[model samples]
Target: MKNPLILLALAATLSATAADAAEVPLYETGPAEDSSFVRFVNGGQQPLEIVATGSNARLTLDTAKPASDFLPIRAGKPIEGALVRGGAKRNVSVTVQPGEFASVVGLDDAAGGLRTVVVHEQPDDFNALKASVAFYNLDAQCASAALLAAGRNIVLLDQVPEGQSKRRQINPVPLSVQLSCAGQAVGQPLDLGTLEAGQRYTVFLVPAGKQSRIFQATDTVAR
Candidate 1:
């Protein structure tokens, strides 16, 4: 027969090991399936920074790079943050439905302060054989923004109003584009390198010093 104290000690060790196993998680938790996505765009002349609540992540936007990649957040919950430009700070919030994508843009307010505009859209769906392009008119001075093929009258996107965006599918090809606002060209032509099939692109018409400039970025999703 086994010694009683020895068996008791062995049993106690087994129990403690079982308890530790129970405390350990089998897998790490990830974002929920119904989570939404959000990104930041700086439409104003000055560079902007965003510090979201409950997160240490910081998103910065400037003239060279006007948009940030999307980040996932809980659906229907407002993602509140502080928008910082130089020494000034202002509160901002954005909300979106489950499975939706949103862009929170910082624009120049009438008082020369910073204001925000939220643009929402469903997850992108497009033909696999073609590329997708979107145009966002965030320049308040541009009442109607139009995108055209450079050196040609070919209009890709036309008559987009301020704070609005439009998307279309196009055959994969190299192209140069120009921005015209309210029937007048705002900036010089921009060369969009060869577009690839199944890829996404976005062009933004943002405000500059008393004029407007165009920015381009490839759209991507977080894994």
Candidate 2:
């Protein structure tokens, strides 16, 4: 739950009664770089992610440049606090609700080209990515990324079916599964020989590596 330092310009807040005027910061969402509210994907599990719907998902800030290029916000519970950066009394406010916009306080060109737009630093919780490695068991079956080295593998599944004369005898149940590990085939499937009665062969999964081998399900017996 890191705080967003660039969004909240710590503007001195005096009661409206004490001051005749209070300035509310302002900005636009027109520029390609400043497409209004910056969009982000919550790759990690964050509660705030529940609200960001479309291209408007954002964490407002006072930095002059896109927060992704400078600093970024991590996905988490909605942040209401602010950060003080570059000698500015900054106070940042944010919400998941869409259609409304907030002005980045410290980013006024009058002082200088403080390229601040309404974006916070990238949130550690989310990523601009689509997929990640998922785990599975690879007993004599195909191993997935979970078992594949460097996220890939050259797994082989070879079987020796009985001759047609024996194939016509009993059932078509598989006796055992085999696996080729490294450069060697570690084991072989038990020979079902001639299928006997209602006997069924059960299969089990063994790990090739902690994160090796992807598991794929098959219904060959039914086939």
TM-score of each: 0.78, 0.18
TM-score of 2: 0.18
Candidate maximizing TM-score: 1
Clashing pairs in 1: none
The sequence of per-residue lDDT tens digits that candidate 1 reaches over residues 1-223 is 2111100111121011111112211011322458666767787768998775554546567877676655556677666777778776777767778877788878776667777777876634556677778888877777667998888968999777777788888899998889887777777999889987777788888777678888787665433
User: Per-residue lDDT for 1-223 in model 2, tens only?
Assistant: 2322232112311111111211211111111222213221111111111112222223422212111211112222233443233343233354322322222222322342222233232111111121111111213233221121221343222231211000011123332233344444344332323322322111212333332221221101100
Q: Candidate 1: where are CA atoms >4 Å away?
A: 1-35
**lDDT (Cα atoms) of all candidates against the true structure:** 0.68, 0.23
Any idea what lDDT model 2 has? Answer: 0.23
